[model samples]
Target: MCQRCEEPERPEEERYLIEVLDQIRENGWCVQGVLGTGSRPSWAYTAGLTAQGLPELVVTGLLPHHAARLLNAAAEQTLHTGPPVPGEQWLLPRLPKLEIVQLSAPAAHLHIAVCCYGAGIEARQLVYADSAGRFPWSPQYNSGRGGQPVLGVRHA
Candidate 1:
């Protein structure tokens, strides 16, 4: 969503945070979500990528702990049935020095505002398991969506 479309509607604090994130990204900083330390790691899937090639990490309708482990190698998290679970992580590996920002709106349980840092391994953040099928990637979504390049579709 564009800043104008999603920003003004946000609460004051949230609006401010979005603005800051905009600035940070503008300054060439990369921001993405990460799993929290000490908390139990949750199940996640990397469904696909945006038209821009950003990976869509889905994290819902997921199998339980054991089931998830058995299927951990899969990228598509949910079956095409069931209620949609909304959670996701937008990875920006193109830009290094990654970090996570927990907006007032909860992001699949991972959070922000602390500036916590350490360890060399990248943190595993998450997003909606259902969102794996969202626009820019899913062919069904590419139809008539006029924002980003609909990868497989040709312009008239």
Candidate 2:
């Protein structure tokens, strides 16, 4: 099931998120769905990463209250699953100061624009305005039917 839509799509972002999460598991972290549609929302699994890793939810096109509810649900589920792997130790000890911009074309809006630094603590300032152009990260998204690796190291 999709976090945005109740029914799943052919090429669902949730699946991609899961795949990336699996990669994280092999490399340095673990990811599981935290919130979505259904009797048992999909996000029950990801609560453990909040302490040890960067566990977050992307809530687009939802009201502030609804988003809060989803977040709370995710937290409760996380607590139910188990505590973080390394307790208070974070995966990315030296997190970079970064900003994220999300564009909603039809609305001509830049619905989400925020900046944050460090691990787990994000100071968000959501801006609502028409976007000037495609966001910087847009180029990183592959339009291919097959979800190929964006960057792969070649052996000599």
Candidate 1: tens digits of C-alpha lDDT, residues 1-156: 666676667677566456645543453222232342333333332221221122322232223552233223222222222212223333322211111222222233223222211111122223221233454334554243422221112111
lDDT for each of the candidates?
0.30, 0.29
At residue 112, give the lDDT of candidate 1.
25
Angstrom error of the Cα, residue 131, model 1: value is 33
For candidate 1, report its TM-score: 0.20
Q: Tell me the lDDT of model 1 at 20.
A: 46
- Scanning candidate 2 in windows of ten residues, the lowest lDDT window is 106-115
What TM-score fits each model?
Answer: 0.20, 0.24
Q: How many clashes show up per model?
A: 9, 4
lDDT of 2 by residue, 34-128 (tens): 33343322211222233343333332323445444544443444345533221122121122111222212211111111111123232111111
* Candidate number with greatest TM-score: 2
